[model samples]
Target: VRLSVPTGFGHMVMSGWLIEFKRQYPDIALDLLFDNRVDDLLRDEVDVAVRVMSEPPQQMVATELAQVRYVTCASESYSREHPM
Candidate 1:
């Protein structure tokens, strides 16, 4: 099965995870597309898509993965200078 993964900031940070997945599922084929836009699955560009912060369409099946808290982190000096 082909899987399409978005190569956003978070994905880039955890790029090494793919290596582990590949080792476990060596038989399955995968095609990775790194972009902010979603591709048409019917066109065969990708089979499974990993989407974050996106509402699911009617034709697609969505599975809830994990919940994460969004935190905006900045340097101490920067925050101190630009206090709210």
Candidate 2:
């Protein structure tokens, strides 16, 4: 299977479980593409694609995979110098 996934966070998340998947399904092979852009599935020869979006197109076959919480922080000095 050719799987398309985002570079950083998503790659980390997928690696967590894919280790077990490989152990269980040793006969199958997975090709993972780590990129931030959404690929044309058919054109890119990708069987599956994972992405993070607040909203997805209504026409697509989609499922709620997981919800991730993100945190933003800066050093005390940087935070003092720049305020949101």
- lDDT by residue (1-84, candidate 1, tens digit) is 666665673376436777787898898766766655565776856766777765777778999665546788889999999995
Residue 59's lDDT within candidate 1 is 79
RMSD of each: 2.5, 1.5
RMSD of 2: 1.5
Worst 10 residues of 2 by lDDT: 55-64
TM-score of each: 0.71, 0.86
* Model 1 ranges with Cα > 4 A deviation: 9-17
Model 2 — TM-score against the truth? 0.86
